[model samples]
Target: MLILPILLAFQTAEGSGYKTNDFALLGSDGKKYTVKTLTKGKPVFLVNLYDMEGSQGIADLNRLSQMTMGKVRVVGLTTLSTRGRGLARVKELGVRFLVLGSDDPYSILDIVPRLVIKEAGSVSYLSNTLLLPDRRLTHVWEGYNRWTLKRMSQDALKYGHVRLKIDFSRFPEKLQRGYGEFYGLGPG
Candidate 1:
């Protein structure tokens, strides 16, 4: 029923040639990091920070991190410099997850171009989360939704050998993905 439409919403006309190159990002500590090195085999939840802002963003991030605690590692990726206000916004949200930014911002865009919308002055992402389970990368996610989290939790339990108990009240049951496809660029 509703899921059909939601799934349709996430369908992308553009083919996604997701690269496997090690994605490097700068942390607030002035250190360079990569997802493989950081996760250490744990399931990693990669979120684009600016894709979400304000109170709702704060709550969703905090809860998602808490929900998958230990079972998954939550990390944030940004195009901002590690030393800037973008880092400050992470603190403002009170999200304790590790956040890293790319020194060459285009690198971040390269990884998830479908998520970005670039105009004359501003850029934005339609999706907020990328849930990377320990299994196939095909199932790697590009949006925030209870179904995806639930699926991720299942993946974590089965693949990462960890259990999870998450409340899905705050997130929508359908999908918070690809709303941008109709508007502009979308997850590729």
Candidate 2:
């Protein structure tokens, strides 16, 4: 009896204040960005990519860009130097989304402390994390998945740190089809 009630309260607290102390990366068109500054008052969708030459990375960016029509601010962070080759690739792909170069994966390091010392290789940075506009991390996915990416976009639109201009009903058909599928609404 008491156990059930205690669990419910714990869940509530988790949702309310789980995101904090996280950071993101932002860049583009020769502009530099600081995660600490960009998330000052808005939610952020931070994507870390190391292999920009791959098919999945390109596809992911394209899909994310479509959802970015003033919905969520998407930023791409890469470990490779964006010099002649990398720069041309990103620009040709029309990476209008912000792109940042990592002096170190400082953004990820600040949040997942273990990831900092872990001896993982390419697989590690491929993971993504979501942070609220005010630098609160709302969700984290250990690996890459389309469904999770889509859900993060939905959460940003629905309960984002900053309010959206249009109503949920006014959202495009693609967006409205599966709104709030993750939460599975029940008693608060």
Candidate 3:
């Protein structure tokens, strides 16, 4: 009996479709910004990672930031309070993109490390939802894969008016191999 309500809550908590609620967050630069302001009529790649120390999440964000530089607006959102070491980690990571503080009033923290794309002022795609159990990644939904990255790049080109071409040759050998394995391009 109790399980039914729990399941219902979980279902409603997921932001799978379009989002209407605008986010107002403090950026790592100590400035408050809204989603629309940051996007500025561009396609946005929004990464939501609650745990600052998630290695995979950090690596993926770093790669995306480098790949989409000057093409798409890459923003990192975190629900964790950036009151202490959280702030330090943001600087230490040397993140080239804006890392904003997310105040999730809707309780969708479970479906985080998510990739949300916005085009022309509305959410066009949401993927890579991970649900963690006891700080351990238990579920991964179509995220950190080559297909998704390719699709995101395509969308940015189609909607954001991005003209920068993706030069995979610039990526490190390790990343190239990782992408190959994820997209089945090179020897697996």
Candidate 4:
């Protein structure tokens, strides 16, 4: 009993071990933004899409924008080159939040759909990544479900004025397993 509580307390204090990388991308609104600038000191929820043309992706972005408004900053990253039709599709979506075009060598396309949580410009958590080809879920992280959404909202409200700290151990067993797998502890 005491050991469990002690472990939870220690885990909470250690914080999530993910970090944000540096990159500047042009937004659909014709402005340039960086990951650090957009997230600033607040917690951010990022969704990376292979392209902006998918209706499901657009709907997800819109829904997330509304659900996280004023509580957590929501940003969309598109791996598709944002030159002609790609940029046009983003404009058509008319998403209220920021949508950035990524031209980085390691595009989101290489990986699956991901939900990244960042606090004070560093990644606090990275949710389970979904394999995009067949839409198969690898279950490697812990922020892509309804429970996580609610928890993130509550956390944002509670820690809006302070630096955020997430206790990963408090999450469900599945999430813990995913986290372990992501770090190569359990199974690959």
lDDT of candidates 1 onward, in order: 0.57, 0.49, 0.47, 0.46
lDDT of 2: 0.49
Off by over 4 Å in 3: 1-17, 102-141, 168-188
Clashing pairs in 4: 128-141
Error of 2 at 87 (Å): 1.8
lDDT of 1 by residue, 1-188 (tens): 88787685553322222433466678756677775666677767666554334434446666787777776777766667666776776677675667777657557666544444333223444244333432223234446677777766666666566777788777777555432222234344
- Residue 72 error, candidate 1, Å: 0.2
Ranking by TM-score: 1, 3, 2, 4
User: How many clashing residue pairs appear in each of the predictions shown?
Assistant: 1, 3, 0, 1
lDDT of 4: 0.46
lDDT of 2 by residue, 78-160 (tens): 65445555567687776767666544534444444322112222233444556666555555543344445555655676667
Selected candidate, larger TM-score, 1 vs 3: 1
Residue pairs that clash (backbone atoms under 3 angstroms), model 2: 27-99, 42-133, 43-133
lDDT per residue for candidate 4 within 1-188, as digits (tens), equals: 78766544312321233233455777766777665566665566555543544444345446666655655666666655565665777767776677667566235433232233222222213332312112222222333444444445454555454233444343343222112122113233
**Candidate 3's error at 9, in angstroms?**
22
Best-fitting candidate, measured by lDDT? 1
TM-score of each: 0.69, 0.57, 0.58, 0.53
